[model samples]
Target: MNQPVSAVAGIGPRNEEVLATMGIYTVGDLLTYFPFRYENHEIQPLSEAEHQQRVTVQGTIHSMPELKFFKGKKSRLTIRILADGLLVKVVFFNQPYMKKQLILNDTVIISGTFDRHRLQITGAIVKPVEKIERGGLEPVYSIKGDLKQHQFRRFVEQVTDGFIHDIEEVLPESLMSRYQLMERKQAVYYLHFPKDEQAFNQARRRMAYEELLLFQLKMQWFRKNERQAGDGQSKSWDAEAVNAFIKRLPFELTTAQEQVLSDILSDLSSIERMNRLLQGDVGSGKTVVAAIAFYANFLAGFQGALMVPTEILAEQHAASLRELFAELKVNIAHLSGSSKVKEKREVLEMLASGEVDLIIGTHALIQEGVNFSNLGLVITDEQHRFGVAQRRTLKQKGLRPDVLFMTATPIPRTLAISAFGDMDVSTIDQLPAGRKPIKTHWGKRNMLQRVLAFVDKEIEKGHQVYVITPLIEESEALEVQNAIELHRTLTEALPHRRCGLMHGRLQHQEKEQAMADFQSNAIQLLVSTTVVEVGVNVPNATVMVIYDADRFGLAQLHQLRGRVGRGADQSHCILLADPKTEVGKERMSIMTETTDGFELSQRDLEMRGPGEFFGVRQSGMPKFKVADLLEDYRILETARNDAAKIIQSGALFEHDSYRSLLMMLESDIAFQEEKVD
Candidate 1:
């Protein structure tokens, strides 16, 4: 089983072990590992096969020559062959065993890179004693560990040839015909071995569409079940209380914000449980809207919990909410792992006794002993920062609380639909009045002194500065500055300057202390990582210097830029980029061109394409292998139409075609029902 014979077409047990060591074992796995590319032999005639554009040559081996060693460092074997009445040279490198496999007058089918002077046959998988048919097309697959391309391709062809008839048609005939998709069996064969580019395209389309359709079907069923099961539970808030909260805001709300708030309040008041996603750009006052929501519920004699991803952010929210609702007479509490045991015990007691109207914290809000007597609203900041389980844990604390998730990351509208199809969406596109745009500028590393001077100017004016670095640690390959190193350098450069350092490696208390110092104006400069991308607001910080701005995505840069321009004072964002590549230049260009986060997000998708921007690992958006949220907008629209049609027909539960889809969705519902805490 471990020999080279296992990979070769027909070798004995003794050869199998030799092959196994090279990593080839079962024939099936061997076959799936295809070549990266094919050397097309059809470009030139067989006579000029060696010189031909790249064609397969069919000829009889005239002689098997002796092995020759070159410079005692390399080995080579040459065979004289006749093809189409012309003589050609077939050469092999470091393959001494091939001499034993090939004989004089044997017909050979060889494939490889070819030049006019020589036929560079990189592989000798097929050595027949007689002339055989050559290639018109070839198959390629991603190489697997211990798998050689030549042997893998041949094995796949053999296995596929044998199982072609056994393949069951998973797609119905009517659907295939309607969509003009290739037959199931033919698609499997053609996908591995395409006759032409057109065939390849058809096979790819069918597979991509099928995968997306299946995922969409599953999402649709889950959404239906949720709406049906979660209906008739949401209670109304006091309208007078909500209107009064809105009226008391320091700045007037934008029309978009007002519309969103109205929709959310209405949903919360309806018989159906509220499941909504609130999307907006950075500094769009989403938190203010959330405050109004919590106030509405608070006035209705219930509690609301705002869950953030970090302790710093949770404390920030608690402070901001307090300021926003100071006149509303709402009692708010902050809870986190950092809270003292006595403090946490007191907060939990208040929560269980219905004394706390609004609570803000990180995961501590979902602690085991923390219970809510009248929890009616659940709000999560930076929704993607926390995992699915964390959100469910908060939901478990309430009696089917109305979940409101907020995110400053602007996703393409098409993606926003599918990713959050289970919930209604409210977008705040317009910024509030008096919100100033951060002036963005591009500069080189040499201009660091000028940027520092600007920071000093801001500091002299009684303002603060945030200097963001791409990395936390120093590395030889990276010429750009790092947070830790820059923090030391700047503090040294300006001896009188009080600078604070914040990064992920720091303990929670240390980070909080650093941030608190910055917030209180004790520190004139704050050097930190992108971990400060969320809801930590310092209105007094008026200058932001981002090093290696190109290294960050446009969406992230937008968030970083947002850290400034929060006060009435004019703020500036200095973007430092190396512009080493096209990608780097493109990303920086976006920052210099636009202050609109949503617009930058769209540009990022267009430049980098959606595949690199979204995935299960990054955005945790639904993973659609071939369906791009930006490019596949048409398909998503079609899926929406199809869903509406099916639902309108009222035959989803009665239709056999949807039965399997419904059953598959049961698992998602069951998973959601589990006690997360």
Candidate 2:
């Protein structure tokens, strides 16, 4: 089945090399490289154009465009094209080669967006009238390396032209009719060369549905297999022991926390393996809930592991837990990368000897040579920090300890279903006692002094402040805020104010020292990066100023705001940005209007679609190709149903046709489990 690369129509040897460089080799790869977007070739009349405007116009070339090079440094080509008796100016930059492509009197389709001066046709495609008819949307795919769109599209069409013929419907007929989905071949054709908006929409729906369905099926299968292989965990504990531990805390548990703890306790008592996700917003007391579960397992005389993402967070959790358990005289230890060799060996020895009731740390907990004595529960903070493999390894440690995963990032229902369908979910939406909402404001760079003054006011009140910058060290482009330089400037500008700096670049101990100083009120203000986005709780911090706020997404801005407003004192989050673009204004708008993280997350999904924003991928959740955990939620739901049906049917386990797919998934799950451990 060695096929010539040229079989994919537009790919000559030179173009093939370009595609190969981009990791595209076979015809299948060319066809599967779906379009990132579409260029509407539905030509618009230029006669409707306004003066000093760039517009799309469908017309024949009235005359051959003149080509002239300027001083040998640049070349310019201009032409007069007529559309319904209206003349439009077509200009090209350094495009003398385009003169040969634009034939005289050719009814070419020109398409480009406009600014207020000239008709820009960066994506002008000529159509020889004698070859075919026109008037449809053009598919524009993401090209790799040096591959031209024109060549890529031509090759895609050729490959798709052949592949579509052999494409059999993977979805069952019963499911297809139930969901009103088009046949696979028709969907592919319409997606590549849609005849109308309706056709495009329908095709996209089908494709999205199929992708989501596959994902849902996989998750549901995992859930079913997990449930069916039950009754391995037999340990159970007295509820009073957990209750006694809770009664010892300084602050009373919120009703929501109690309810979630009840759910956790119930899950842990079950013989079936526990796979639960506890979704809580920042400062919603997920830690207390996790602590209760850990204590419950300890009361049952089994060990527990609480894994956090950072050494700082790990140390914080271990310290807080140790203090809390000291009331009941329980033993606790922490193991992180920074732990000394003697200390690490001691912790490992205690764990193996069943002397330590609970162990808390970062990835060091997953490192080799660390053994747990009767490990009964595994809790992961900010679930995204650890992959599935990490969680699995911890669970596999003690005959599959009950797993409790917690996240402060509130995910949409659709996103949760897609990403965490295999695990049962418990949400803690209520804030704890005396927590106040952070007041949000949108300002520009010109209002810097006012924000600085406000920071001074908060400091004067004996409250600490946080000034967040998008960059940690320094960047050549974004000059408005740099934590390192700002720390120095603030130290000099406000001599009375004790300022400290914390960023990702600093050593672990340096960060810990800075944060500790800020917590002790030694630093009146802390200038830092987003390293403090999660798990850093400072009740005294009353003001947060984010520079170049436009650079951060709505959800992230919400998360940073969550860093504040934790105490009884009223807090403010000032969003400062130079509104030079429409996107900047939109981001500022989102910050002012919403205090809800979920709402902000939805808005973020809408504004940015899906791409990287402020270093966190637009999703900020997890990575998935061919599946959008947010936009394709409906498809996920449908896929879940399909997966349930397939598992119930029991045909897949026997069918050799799907044996390879099953093996691949199982192998991946095993590998993931190993990696996480």
Candidate 3:
């Protein structure tokens, strides 16, 4: 099964290179490359077919196939076929060679879109009835570059026939009996060429279960190994002192906040190192909860470090922490890439000397010169923004310090389990007291004047506004507004208001200055891209206007909306978009209907699958070929439970039943480690 593609029959160097482009390097890859969908060859009458419906029609050629040569090498072949006493025109593009095969009066099966209004069939696949297997399903694969569907299908068929029996089973016999699953080899073969719908369903169920089970086992194994690597320091702190500090806060803590804080403190005092994810919506008092955790870490005689994504966010967090810890006398330091050299050096010295109890910074905290005398806790804000290696680098600065990750982007529960199953999760489901929900409105481009008038009114009331554009600069491809052009236009439209522009293309200092100007109310309107989507809080910024709002996902739209409604006063989010699709319109409607991040996240996951929900690359989510995190959540839950039981029973390494599973897990771990390196 592990043999290279060159070992296969009829596959030469050229075909091998093409297969490599599709990630089919080994025979095993070829066998397991399941088709996305299957097309049934069951014939249907033309009279029963709806317009633009995909159907298979068996017809006799009624006219000679006309082949016409077009621009450069392009060609088209057209023919007339009679099915159910109805004559339909069949068209094939870029397939002039098919004219010779399609003979007049020959019975052929054509499968593609059937347009009833035009009496036309756009033929995707056409084969003579005598040569084609009737009442069978044809697999459709996603291929690229020079490899046609027939060629790829032949490759998979050949591999399956030759190596199907070589596929080893990972599930134990007990599980196989309990679940009534077919053999792995049979399932793999059936997935490529199923005899019936039931066969295909069984194959899919077996394969999906195996993939999910292996993924869960890998997560459980890694967690077990991490816990066994070293003993966590049992940090002790005064609970009454922490309570007193929380009581001293200017605002009361929500019940959700208190619960999450309690979870963090409980983890801190345990001998097991804490690896937790704290999720909350924007302006849900997560920062305050983090402050309490830092205070607890300080009381335990261990320094804590907070790492954020941007300098602007780091500074904001620093200011908030300073005010929150004022009476406690805890020394806090702020560091960033643009910090003055002398100040940075002094901060580093104080950190290494154990003088700074808490430090908040951007990626600068993980730099070479940064060190800590007793770093016991590390908190990364907007955790998804940082890569695994970046987080690991900061954690490596200390001796297995407890790690806490915070993200304002609330992921759905299904994704949370699949992506962060290795760590514990705590959610702040409630917002702080007296915080009014942001009012959202959808507007068309024709209503720009009205939206601008609303912005002007908000500015007159001494509040700032955020004008979000989808692009940084104008492009011929997209007709939406760009940040630079929008900034110029807004500045011209409202001459009395000051407009500041910020985007990813700007220098760190320039972006910082823009944010500072906006924070200081020097800029009444800020026209920016999605750079300000996370952790840029300004209570006076009461209005958010997003142009081309349909271009963004639901989660991102929710995050942008969260920028407003940070203060007690009522806020508004104006979505200026003329959506062309139902999905886009639904997204705008959902944004206007609710401000709950988790609900929007779930809807977003349902709309755009898990791979795109958090961006597969940075999300640390497993890329399962068969199982879907959203659709197969119940299977995932079962797999998780089964894996936990297997690990707890201490039979994974000791019993023969789990030998193959263990080997597969170890190989996956090695591959992951290689990727990280």
User: Can you give the TM-score per candidate against the true fold?
Assistant: 0.81, 0.88, 0.94
- Judged by lDDT, which candidate is best? 3
lDDT of 2 by residue, 204-253 (tens): 78877776665565677677666655644756778777677777788998
Quantify all predictions' global Cα lDDT against the true fold: 0.74, 0.75, 0.88
Comparing 1 and 3 by lDDT, which wins? 3
Q: Kindly list the per-residue Cα lDDT of model 1 for residues 383-480, writing each as its tens digit.
A: 86776777888988988788899999887776676666666788899877887888999998888888888888889999999999988899899887
Model 1: residues >4 Å from true position, as ranges? 1-137, 170-178, 229-232, 476-480, 606-615, 618-631, 647-652, 657-677
Question: Candidate 1, which ten residues in sequence have the lowest lDDT sum?
Answer: 668-677
Report the C-alpha lDDT of model 3 over 133-184, residue by residue, as the tens digit. 4237778898988888888887887887788889999889998999899899
Error of 2 at 449 (Å): 3.4
RMSD of each: 5.9, 3.9, 2.6
Task: State the TM-score for model 1.
Answer: 0.81
Which stretches in model 2 have alpha-carbon errors above 4 Å? 1-17, 20-23, 42-60, 68-76, 81-94, 101-125, 131-135, 610-630, 649-651, 654-677
